[model samples]
Target: MTRIRISSGSRFEEEIGYSRAVIDGDHVWVSGTTGYDYAAMTIAEDVVAQARQTFENIAAALAQAGCSLDDVVRVLFIVPRREDWEPCWPVVKQYLGNARPASTLIHAGLQTDAMRIEIEVTARRPA
Candidate 1:
């Protein structure tokens, strides 16, 4: 198997030495993506908006690997506070509403002060 790195100008990736996503044949592993806009590099204040941005970022990575949310077999989400979980859930539901891949949520710390959530997804494309 060969590894292909996928990057989309996420500063952390450049500074931390990891690709936004990695493709190994039919398997695509998208790194955890925050809500920060890649272009503006800004994070939204509202939890719902932030969650949407995070999903969009993850979608972008999956698209690079020749797949979409439909191809995602799993999703992992992290939030800073327990109270934010409910607010974020609808956002995840909105984007991956029908796809309904196996998902998990964790309440913990984030990388930056402005960031409140992080998302990582694994997807498979037919060979």
Candidate 2:
């Protein structure tokens, strides 16, 4: 088995000393990802919009790991405000309903106030 590190080019990864995701054997573990559009470095104010962007970021990372959202087996969601969680349901379903991965949601402050949602996931590449 070989270990591989994937990067999203987010400055935080370099500054914080972490890879966006790591591929160890058949598993892909993505770091807690925020909604910032890495290219533009901007995040939407709406939690729903942020949720969508967060999934996109995760999808990109998964893609780099030779998998997709459908390959995800576990997911964790973190939101600063509990109320914001329900509003993001539709976006979550839209992106991850197929995989229906085991999931957990936690209410906690993020690295930045502007980040309404942060998502992390674990996936396995198809055998």
Candidate 3:
């Protein structure tokens, strides 16, 4: 099988030597993605907006890997503050609720205070 690496043009990917997502055969693994709008390089203060942007970013990466949110089999969410999770739930449900992927939420510190959420996902292309 050949390995394909997808880049979101984030400076950190090059600095950290990591691809945003990698595809090997039918599987796709998207790296932990933050809420930063790569084009504007800014994140929203509100968690809801951040959550929306986060999914948008993930969708783009998945598209590059020839998949979509519906193809995801698992999802992981990281939040610096537990309280912020509920506020972001609506957006989360809007995207992944129907797919109902195996999901996990972790309360942990992120790289910055402004960064409230980060999400990572694993997907498989149907054979």
| TM-score of every candidate relative to the true structure | 0.93, 0.98, 0.97
Model 2: weakest 10-residue lDDT segment is 106-115
Tens-digit lDDT track of model 1 for 17-48? 99999999888999888888899988898888
lDDT of 2 by residue, 25-97 (tens): 9999999999999999999999999999999999999999999999999999999999999999999999999
Ranking by lDDT: 2, 3, 1
Q: Stretches of candidate 1 above 4 Å error?
A: none
Candidate 1 CA-lDDT value: 0.86
- The model with the greatest lDDT is 2
* 19-121 per-residue lDDT for model 3 (tens digits): 9999999999999999999998999999889999999999999999888999999999999888999999889989998689999999999989999999999
Of the two candidates 1 and 2, the one with more favorable lDDT, higher being better, is 2
Give me the overall lDDT of model 2. Answer: 0.95
